[model samples]
Target: MTTLFKAPAKDKAALEEGAALSPRFDGSGLVTAVVADSHDNEILMLAHMNEEALRLTIETGIAHYWSRSRNSLWKKGETSGNLQMVDEIRFDCDQDAVLLKVRVGGADATCHTGRRSCFYRKVVTDGGQTRLEIDAEPRFDPTTVYTDH
Candidate 1:
């Protein structure tokens, strides 16, 4: 079953050109990566993707991200079953970045902390002390959510 979106071209030149023109990570031009939701409209996450990760994501139809923390490529939902199935990919005007719209299957929430989104927390200042406030609760628990899978 095809999702409702168009996949980006797989040309090497197009991919390189697009990634190069993407917004810089440290104020220097460098296209990292992008991810969206099933509808191909809502942006789900923004994480860096190396060449291997990009290739794997494209070839496998699943989201693969370069883990700056783990220093390796990570396949989304490998452990949690919050798999992000790639629906489509598109490039911005400058071809320096791309947007991946995906369909998340099973009980997996997008956030590593088990929230529906990675942006679940909001910073709030209480009595001059900066604190994190939970924007929402987890849609499902990582432990029991994907047991059937």
Candidate 2:
């Protein structure tokens, strides 16, 4: 697919200060996308965007991501009905990463596990034994929501 953005400028000053949306995709042709809830500024998930995914998200006002495991472009919450309606998008100075402020629809969940956010655990160290503990409750039942699972 043709890219909507030009190749990122090589000049450090231009890349950092210029008013452009030229994303500096990594070697894998992807940029990191950090998604957050627009309402409370809660981070929902961390995903990646290929050129196509980024274009689609910008054009559609919805979240789109490149699923590394699936190796395909994915529309966020397509099956789970928890679509992220993007309110704002911001990029870092170098444009290697993006921050998406979105409002979730439907069950207000963003995780395949039916949680509001993908980060539902907190790491703790008990006597040098590190473990992850659940920090959030599931907003919906995955078994009832995801038919293919």
Best-fitting candidate, scored by TM-score: 2
TM-score of each: 0.65, 0.95
lDDT of 1: 0.68
Structure candidate 1, residue pairs in collision? 18-95, 18-96, 22-96
RMSD of each: 7.7, 1.2
Cα lDDT, all candidates: 0.68, 0.93
Model 2 per-residue lDDT tens digits across residues 16-118: 9998779999999999999999989999999999999999999999999999998999999898899999999999999999999999999999988988999
- Worst 10 contiguous positions by lDDT, candidate 2: 1-10
lDDT of 2 at 126: 98
How many clashing pairs per prediction, in order?
3, 0
Off by over 4 Å in 1: 1-30, 122-132, 142-149
